[model samples]
Target: MNEPGDIEVERELVRAMNDSAGNEPVPAYDPQQLAASGRRHRRQVWALAASVAAVAALGAGLAALLSGGGPSHTVPVTAGPAAPRPVGSPPASAPDAARGWATMRTVLLAAERYENPATRGTVQLGQVAALFTDQAAFTRVWGSGGLGATCGAVADGALTMDHSGVLLYRGSVQLPDHAAFTFDDRTGRISGVSCGSGQLPGGLGHQTIAAVFGSQVSGGKAGDGLVGPQVSSLDCSPADRPLTNWYGDIATGGGLAVPPTWQWQVTLNGDQADGPLSAVVDHTGLMTQATCPTSSP
Candidate 1:
């Protein structure tokens, strides 16, 4: 009885053991390789950490934008040019000259009214005197020597304007006489009077004097010689008449001297005459002995 199957199993088991014993031993692990693997693991971990940090930074930027804490960007604006100013108009010298002529007309009208026979008196003369710059001259010419009564009465009058801007008032005041008045363009005051012809006999009246000279007279005893018969001695010469003349010595009631500039000539019947018949008043309304240019005919 040979058990050949059991012998085969025993032979197989012996072969398995012999094969296991014949296999080579396993080698030891390498430290360098393990270190290299650990390093690779650490690199993977660092890569993951860097990715997480990038995501966190992106979140912080988004939060800053949402909170309106970002820097501002501005755009530039442009402007336009300015506008110009307007010009003005010219002066009204022509109208002013016309007004000046009107003023002269008013003065003539006042003088004519004062010379009315019914209105003859010191009270009436005073009203006329107010128009003159020299009150004393007014009194001397009208109130003295009974001149107002002597001058007779004015009947009618006519006013004529000259190209030279002189106002000639021709009237029949108990005689055929013409009184011319020159007005100062700047002051509008009567600057001079060229009176004479028929009205000189009674001497210049208050209205006559005031109509030519403005209402101002030099006050003081020095000017007192201008009154009375002494005024008759004034060098009112017609030809080559010196502009300046001295009348009445200062010792004799104080002398009155005419400056060279206050030149005024009274042409009577084509001949210049002396006396208080004609006068030129300075801008100050004071009577000056200065000779004025002979008035144009």
Candidate 2:
């Protein structure tokens, strides 16, 4: 509605508005500040990613440990019977040692009865001789009538190793259980044998002897000294002493995998001619095997 005169006033008003805006303050742009802000933002992003990666790795390890997956760092074990060894092996270490020694005692008793020159036809049985490293070793150990004393060890009590390879009876000097032998550290074989107790299976005991020879023998161990037919009992005729008696044939009426049967085998005689007198006895003092006639006129 302004005429040509009003047009000039409108132009002046616009110019005044621009002049007032120019007087107000405005921030100056600094390239360095912008650059630093951009750098900080990128650093924050990287830090977040690194934290996530560490957490993932930690979680994986925990999972593996809990589940027993991935490579394990633990040892594995299996259970079963020990490998079969010939009679009179050195035996196990402590804990199971007492039992092993007891078994050893029984084995040695059988050795003296069966291997003694008077009792056995051969110089010695292969099983008894196998305890030593070699034939020479066996001769060395058995020469000079040393078999009786060596076999007599572990007679009265539990046998234990003194860490120096010496056997201790109930672990006391006053109560010494003579050492039967020592083992080689490098070879795990018998190094030597010595004796002081001078013991022998002596005799099986009155009850055991009674089972073999009724009132014929006065004492139990009297027959231990006799040889050949002299020691023959009610069952055997020309029977010699047992060659070897231990738990004997684990497969016999008991399970092989069972615990030692605790029952020891007591042979009336092992003549090889009589085949162990057609009978055997055990710790219970019972006649486990009785293949004999009741009596004769």
Candidate 3:
């Protein structure tokens, strides 16, 4: 019940934790919290990709007022079935590994026709490029200033070294819908990118994402310990190995987080679909989820 733009992402994360108190290191962050956390995480990744479009437009305006409230009236509701098809596999090749998975499914259908939030652009990258290998290691793996900055395609290919022989060239990027990019296909680099839950931002209208994390999502709480809980389900298959980020070049700037950070980890499945189910992302893209039996059964 937050989504008013997540009350401005909890008052801009409480004014970026009161301007990064004491430590005095994490300061210099004011590009409007880097453009309101990348437009409220792309409107929480299109509200997790049309989660029933605002309750199907309030159930089609209550079935057109129950067909004009006539014909012996009847409006019972129960729905909650259809939600299967979520296994995993595919997208894990390495003969040379510089971009496989059929060019990451045509760069996730051309970055889903360029940020198609249902349609027409802005950002959404839905399938997150099914987890990359091509498209220049998915713009260095999910290009990020923090959120939006993707580019795609660049690895010329032709370098073989796996078995930790290490040459690395895979690809992935699709934050359009909030998160994805799995790099390395031959120096086009970026080893992993996952981001979870179709795209999470249910803090809804969170007062315009808490006026752009002006305080770091209100000094810890919503999933505490770095953000966990809330999210329900999410998956991005393919991962035999390679998804590192030792500080892939470091330089987050306004998008927060310094000292070269950009990590990965995903497996959400939030809405309690069984299993301990837990997902976590950090290094500053900030993602969370947890039921914690120890995280995923």
Candidate 4:
């Protein structure tokens, strides 16, 4: 069963393929095709990752799905998931998120994302000092190497509370990996920053992910790939959830090979116990997944 708007993905893919400069009619991709064509190849790569748990990195590339005779237009859109999608709630009765939480989240994410070698010890650090509760601690170990319990974006998307009443703020990177902060709303400071999982492979699309895992969702309440890795501890799903686009970034060289495309998906890496299983729908109705490293090397 396809998600509500999965047909839209297929329609969009067909439209994109039709508009390509020089190419034949492109058919909406089938997850099974991507799954079957690369069975042995995936085994080899996964075997390598399994042997070296630390080597579980994401592969980045433009999805050039082949058509009948051979691969054609660069169709790279994430697949759509059915109902029972990731709910931004844990087991507890999460309280209504503070209005400022969303605003501060945007600010903190940008500030952390902007941190780099050049910005080290610069005014930018002091500029966002008010965001963190323990400026010294946050600054001491701010850039990369991990921040929250899960190294990858185990708990991303909307905000929620845990059983202990701790705010599960977005604990991850703009890219490269995931993690979270146990924010103290009272003090307007992060009480906990954890990154037990290590950096994950970055910039992979749904085709790559579905090829890698076969899009079976071996274990989940829905088994339809929705309600995937926990999104939050809030207990209910939000009316409007944000979707992560998997467009090939020029900076990362994921688009130079072929024409760039767009994809949007919910977070499927919130349950730290379930490995780095990202779920997204590609243009041809394929779910994407990236195994974020469990621990740093």
Q: Work out the TM-score per prediction.
A: 0.25, 0.34, 0.16, 0.25
lDDT of 2 by residue, 146-241 (tens): 343344432212222222222222111213344555443323444356654434231222233332342222223433332233223443333443
The order of the candidates by TM-score, greatest first, is 2, 4, 1, 3
* lDDT for position 137 in model 4: 54
State each model's CA lDDT, in order.
0.39, 0.42, 0.35, 0.36
CA error at residue 95 for candidate 4, angstroms: 6.7
All candidates in order of lDDT, best leading:
2, 1, 4, 3
Best by lDDT: 2
lDDT of 4 by residue, 50-162 (tens): 86764332111122223234334577988887546223322121332333243244333333234323322322445455555566656543544223322333222222121
Model 4, position 147: C-alpha lDDT score? 33
TM-score for predicted model 2 compared with the true structure: 0.34
Clashing pairs in 2: 169-177
For 94-211, candidate 3 gives per-residue lDDT tens digits of 5433344324323433332343233224333544433444555455555642122223322211111111111111122212222344444443333444433343322212221112
Write down the lDDT that model 1 would get.
Answer: 0.39
lDDT of 1 by residue, 1-297 (tens): 659998999999999998998896878999999999999999999999999999998788788889987665577867666444221111125664454444444444444434544433313444555444366544543433323312333422332323222222222112344444444444343444444443322111223232322111112133332333323333334455321211110011111433222323332221222332344434333443423224421
Model 2 off-target regions past 4 Å? 1-43, 56-110, 113-118, 124-181, 185-188, 193-244, 247-297
CA shift at 106, candidate 1, in angstroms? Answer: 2.1
Error of 3 at 74 (Å): 35
